[model samples]
Target: MVRWHVWIKEHEFLGKKGTSQDGFRDLLRASPTPKAVTGRNLSSEDLSKSSLQGRYEISRYAPVCLWEEDFSEVKQAFDDLRNRGIRDFRRHFEKHPEEILSFAGKVKINDVNEYTLELYQAKTKEDLLKGLEIVFSKQSYEVFKEELIALADGKTRFMSEAVNRTLNGEQIHILLSLAVPPGYKESLSRVIVCITDISAKQRKARELERIGEKYRKIFQNAIDAMFVADTETGIIMEANESAGKLLGMSTIQMVGMHFTEFHPKEEREAYRSIFEKHASRGRSLSDNLLVCQRNGRKIPVLFSSSIISLDGRNYIVGMFRRVLSPDHAQRHARAGKSLVTERKVSSHAKERLSGREREVLTLIAGGMSNRQMAEILCISEKTVETHRTRVMNKLNLHKTADLVRYAIASGFVS
Candidate 1:
């Protein structure tokens, strides 16, 4: 009778302890600092059911939690937990199996998702484009990609936030995440930006699209026979206004034609062979090409092709300008005449010197002193001077400075 009474009293005491909210508080107050402030509000995160490791193991005590004496009754109402795993009965009733599988991995998001950064001043969209242009416009994409990644890795001034005026006449914080993908530390840092206002992004995108459409209209109507060719295949994909005049067909018909069609009949094979060689090695090739005109007349043309990668495809942009030889020839003829005149003048100055004096004159023009010239020729400084003096008189150059200036103008220094 005494044992039965003691057991009944013990059960009643534990039942009351489990029912009280203050009971959990009392446990936390007892353990001064559980795991460096152990039983405190846990690492700020989404609510989960995992049993915490410290004094406050909420998952275990949840069964006897206030309104529910037995949580197992709420879930299984059957025997036990039985180490829930692959063959767990409670998990089998999940409405969508994939939804259960998704819980296996972390949600995986960048830390510090959004925050207010107090910039000294707010920047407009044009200001941002100017900064991006400094890296993208001059350098190739490959170089620019590496440069942005380097800046983000150092945590420099590249990544920052600012305030922007929202359409509602209020300021909102705009955040830019220069966050690397979790595992890709060595590759380029890709930024995923966040704006509090969704309408702002749509407005900017629409304005830019309008600008691109305007340029497209002009490109299609331009006078020059502009062709955007696939650099790898040499096939012309886009042809503009004057292409029809040259090919005796509309731009639609010429779209399927290869650039080799523009070559002369006999030189077609040889011309294509050289272009293939340059394209394979990623080199730009250009020459004065002869394109047979639509009227069966051969026209003299100057064509220049540059390799560009646009929309993830390599394209050869070819521009043709008619070469009026009378204009070009007159310019070339003048250039040739100047070349001969300079040569004659320089030749006359070189004539009044011995062979050894000419050697010293050549070295002096090459920006070498008497000592360097002597070292190169395996001769002494005194020997170099004797040669220099004789050459100076022959050239009427009294001062060394005058000799240098003459050498530059006469094309010897170059």
Candidate 2:
């Protein structure tokens, strides 16, 4: 044997300070061979064993319960069944479930992590294995058998939610994932199964679905019209039944259309500006707007709007209520003047005025200038001015404002 000099570094001291070379030599002599300064014995077998032990330690502390199962026996049984002229494996398995159950029994639980013991409330690995029969009932076994067959037919992985029972007979929902390691054929493979308890997650999902259904009913039956639109483009995303009825359009027709389409062409731009301003500042309310129906009727409406964040995007949710104008109320009132009577009264009051004069008067009462009235009535500005003069003279009004007051009082501009 050759003599070797080892200079033990201060950091290499395992227990106490000032552990000299002489003390290390004594320790080396006490052992059969000198251990490496790295604290591991130098041997090929020891290195391999340490690597496996490290992997085992990682698996033991893993968040999910890990299982290694041998499916070779099941694969052999499947081959035997196929040899017996069973071409439709699924139908055969369903009819002769005993064969599938027998093969399931052949699946050996080669190993399991410590988490498996904790999850199943088992005192030992042996106890957990013994309880596997009770944990997997006949119904669940059929479902598992189908996945197992798929896995054996070159499918490298499988995932599904499964119902399992613990040792205490408490059922748990588990998200199960099974995969075969690379370079291993399914027939001769060891499957690695990862199980995560998803009972709470399933419960939460069901609760959210229930809440969503409840809100959907409320939205459909609401009396006020509701619209959800894209904040950036003003495109309608969703409209309730009330909104469709109020706007005189079907719900299907309202979706994907621009929200501004329901307003008068002249007011669309102004409405858009106000909507943007309110959205930027959070929320806004307006009671002076009118929504146009498909029949060309402009109905005054009260609107309240707010910005809503959904799925990381901004949306505008608006609620609208029809506002009953004085004219609208008069039209619908039961004891009010009949249509013929109202028309007669309207004609009698305006008998002294020409059609052009009446038109100019209405436009003037609506705050239109001569230029606007001329453009709208398809005439010249000088002609509009002449009509205004005649209207003021015929009405015996001294000022232009007086003409407006007279037109309003007579319901000419309503």
Candidate 3:
């Protein structure tokens, strides 16, 4: 690891450490909204306040070793443009009494050589630098460097707390947090530069909150109970208010409990198989075989799901609608689920089957016998059986009812 800067540790230049450091720096430099990562030009809706911590403090480390120091002992940053590159950077510190930097920069003049010490205050930055031209006549460079760092550190803390709470992707035009402390109370007399990426927990928390709100609207307003289960863990990740009512328990008592707990140990295997299939294959909406509810009642649930990302991990977001009585399907027709079901394709198995074979499968789902299908398609009964055999082999459906269900589910027919 080549040590280039005092604040930038040597590990930052190697393998995983390098990528991690780069990602973190990019994240901070990156806009907080989703659009930034997606490569979409950001509108005002997607914005976060990007600010500096405070006015810059330029300082040099005392007792500096050019080699082997992580440079954290003094809790300071360095000015390294003078060092120019890695080779020179190492020599500067190894030789002692020099500074190095990353993530921040300040103006420099040819004056203030390696051995001076000085410090002074000015009302404005312009005035400060302007006076530096003549005022150093009274001070040493070491004192000047310390006073500068202390002042800059004070500003850094305040700016860190200046928050940008983004709602959806709204454009934010707040103060630049650069070089400032977050608040008056948080002001520290001295602070070290923090350059790590530690913002995921907060950002992910906000994203999950947003998803909860979106799903809540649908679950609370929909005419059915909604349940979400984790495929890998087999735990109930989320369930809407109606889920408790459908499961025959109060909402408070039902949450934080596993879905499998309500089922017979034997039935869990079947449910797990289906869930894993959905998670791996990306099937969209599915309906009940059965999901046991509270009070030990097995209720038929119409299930639906979509793939979603949260906190940088993939999860299946789901909906569960109770498939009630005979009238429920009819009620759902008006509300949306039945109409959706009607569009199901019954012949997904025939998706890759030849046209002649598809004709046979469709006839089978339509309740036609082989002889009847052959007669209608103007083929011999033997040809109809051949097509049927091919269809079954491809779809792996040995039973007629399974063929009918597969067809209906994939919207194979109206």
Candidate 4:
């Protein structure tokens, strides 16, 4: 290509077509002026025009905003700063922010393509360049400081996200990439910068954040304890305040713990099986399950869970409510067992005891000691004993084993 351009120049075929030793030269003659040229008499103005023309050609139809700037003035100031033993441009600029503003003023905008004008809502490149103070927001100074630091560290290229304002005073987000031409790193004369508008992406991010905050409030304030775990890893991703309070720990302390850690250590396999089933089926409900608190007390809870998908990954959101009474646990347990068996307990026998008495009976059927029952039900041991005596007396059961058998027969526990 360079050879063809040289041939076109050598042949003085500026605006005429003619055949040459290289047949393609005849084809190139009819085309517009090529960007590259080589000759002893090439003036700087001619080179500048050629460079700007080439930039326009390359970036005229580009989607990103392109900027050709000269940082030679900023480079000289940096050199002066270095001579004064200032090595860290970032720290120095942080303390003396006015220097960055001064350097920004000295930096020159060489050229900007059509897209740059459109992005900044400028009708002409001159308007965009002259009104740079309006185009650059305060946030842009932070990015400018970082770029200066990169130049000080001998970096040839830098990229970052920043905020800039339009001519209309509307803020826009931009992904800025700045690079110096291969040999111009020290001189900082030919710096090419591109800005990709990311205002839409940032707006979407903020919308998602607002939606997340809304759901977060719902989760934290929910009456039922809630937990979210990764479907694949079974590691707890999040836990709400209710979950932490129910288990006697801070919500943050529950995150990163294995899903099975909240359940009884002795019942790990059973709870793991339940977790795996929920993950596979995308939903689950169960009773007769035990949750272990921080104090090592196991309490019965009605657990329900459903799977949710986000960003192509699946998660399980489980909600737990502590069983208020044995009747409640028995009702859930019966609902769960109905799928496997059609056996139903007599309504008369079920209605014989109150909810509290039925709960005592269910705990007794589960072989829980009176002290364990007190801890789980948040009641005194004497209160638990009283409920137990009432349960036996109301049923006319003479022995503890008889009461257990009665509870099983009534479809309260398996």
Candidate 5:
């Protein structure tokens, strides 16, 4: 047996004692050949062995699960399979899925660290090695097949995510990093594998995906026209269904178009200035804006915008509310002047009005015209006009000011 021991100070067990009080300092300044052992020197093999032992010590105490595997047998098995005219391992494995487990059994587990045992809930190395199949999940076969292909192609390293299980049958998400050590690629005699637990990270990711899906559904089904744009580029990143309908375009068509493109070309520069001001100030509302539809018809809208940040980039979320008309301000002031009338809608007129007609009347009292009501109710302008006409005929109120007074006296809008 050959053994080596390094001591900082001479011990009594070696039957040796240092003369100087500072043994370390003296040793550093000593001759290459000490007088006590002048002819004896450490061999090259001894130094190499000691270096390997140091590395083994490091692996034993590492915090992560470390594995040392021998793949020479598996390599030979692959060679035999390839010689049998099996060029596509993936297709062959797919046809004979059970062969994957058979090949996995061929891989020899040379050694594993303490952390490996802990991670698999094994009390000892032997316990883990005895039931190796219990730790692998069904998904592991896919990852293993990829590793095999990488090995067949002479790749030096491979990395992937896989699902594993513990002895107690608890599933674990893990990231596996596998590599052939330098000079070992030809024989693949020594392969190193590292496994990191990523269960918590994957769980959080899944949770975020669910939350994002929920909000995405809400945004797509919103009642108001909404847009998300890049402030720097002025490009529309997102538009909801209501926005597409109001602008006479599909949601797909609205995306990637400039925000100013939806406005009148002659007034684009003015709208761009307002958009920049809204983006800079973080939040704004302007009712004097107009949006041009695909058919070249212009519609007045109340536009409100707020700045938002997502994934380190700033964006503007703008919402558009359709207004009564281009001359709505004058009509609104006129309606306000006649709201103090004592004339109330009769019960006969109230009963004659259908639900939709009454709804239109209420919206009219709220200062919405046919186009604006059509946008809000998601109906056509003709349908909204029909409802408005029915309400007027039922109430015997033809003027806009008379409808406003009647709606107020009837307690439809307060």
Candidate 6:
């Protein structure tokens, strides 16, 4: 017999004695290979459990108030009203608000987060539930009812900016989101409602609206011509009524036109340089600038420009005043070194006279009658007479000869 060593280690057998092949086979048969261990099934179960736990925690500790409401009673009440031939549920609810208010008792508040208590200034959840009736004023209840009906009918998933009151009687604005959980019909659905405080946001929006309205009124009624243009492209974005009148164009026609459109072709490059320089430095004043009107009339204007920022974009705002009289035009022209020699009046006496008054004085010095002056000026005789009187009073001249002498002395006439 041959000796063989057999060693047993844990559950496996190693032979030390001489063994037959059958005995070795029997040992191999008795010890089958251990099955492969896998945690896939266990992992799937843990994942589902953790997912539900996460949802629960989120609902319980959310920043805003979250609640699950049972609307079974409200549905039943509406069904009863429908059986009584009330086709329009809204109309019925409006007429019988007391009945609708009674239906609130049937609705159950299933859960509420900590935010609910804090928002309502309640010490406990029960305190909040008890004071829920005070939260819905008459107007708020009306709004709430409409939202509830829409939610039950699956018409909308969310409603926002609903006004509510707190336990302390402070008004609060809320945005509400509604959802129906799985396996629930509309009538008996468990609705999850999320409430967010939007009181501050609503107040800010209304304030901005009021400010915009005030600015609109001021812009529309301003006396001076106003133009708003894109700073980079020089394209006109907005023009006031006065601007259109000054340019002899409609407001609609003025918009979308380039700023250079109002300048003479020869002076457009100069004006562009001035605009760019002023825009870079914040403001600029160009006196005696000639603006070409839509009717081909050249209007002497004083252009005041400033850079304004709106909605994070830079814009150029220009205010312009028309030169009404020749005297005024000459004065502005002299400032720009473009004075007209023929229209120049050197008399100190004519300095006190306005453009219209100077025109009347020059004609008076030429021996023109009031009616002739009116005809030449395309004005009424009465208006011409008024201008003559003002000129005489300003010069303290009693007679036409004295006015004519003064006009000649002032170089207003040949």
The per-prediction CA RMSD against the true structure, in angstroms, equals: 23.2, 19.0, 21.7, 15.5, 14.7, 22.9
Top TM-score model: 5
Between prediction 1 and prediction 2, which has the larger TM-score? 2
The models' CA-based lDDT, in order, is 0.45, 0.65, 0.43, 0.69, 0.69, 0.64
What are the per-residue Cα lDDT tens digits for candidate 4 across 319-404? 66665455754665455453212323344655777756766776787677897656445469999999988876666666787676
Order candidates by TM-score, high to low.
Answer: 5, 2, 4, 6, 1, 3
Candidate 1's residue-wise lDDT over 215-240, tens digit each?
56655754445687886788989887
Mind giving the per-residue lDDT tens digits that candidate 2 earns over 1-414?
A: 000011112111121112323222211121222235277566867754454444445555666776766678877876777788766777776787666656666777777777878988899989988888556655576567667566546665666667778888988777766665554464643555677777899889989999878767755765667788888888999899989989898999999999889999889999888877776776534334789999878987656555768788888877666655566545444333333233233355567876557656766766777875564444689999988888766665656766655665554534
lDDT of 3 by residue, 1-414 (tens): 111111223212111111222222222332223435346565554333211111001112221111111222223233333344433433444355344222112323212211112112234334433543343221223333333353433323212211222222222122211122222113221122322222455578779899778656755554445555555665666666767666777666655666666556678877666678877886554444566755566766545566555666555665454444545434434443332334343445345766556545555755777765553444588888888778778877677766665444443322
Alpha-carbon runs more than 4 Å astray in model 2: 1-45, 85-99, 137-142, 181-189, 327-414
| TM-score, prediction 3 | 0.34
Clashing pairs in 1: 35-38
Looking at candidate 5, the ten consecutive residues that score lowest on lDDT are 1-10
RMSD of 1: 23.2
- Per-prediction backbone clash count: 1, 0, 46, 1, 0, 6
Instruction: Please give the range of 10 consecutive residues that has the lowest summed lDDT in model 1.
Output: 1-10
Quality of model 3 by C-alpha lDDT: 0.43
- Candidate 6 C-alpha error for residue 67, in Å: 1.8
Give candidate 5's total backbone clashes. 0
Q: How far is candidate 2 from the true structure (C-alpha RMSD, Å)?
A: 19.0
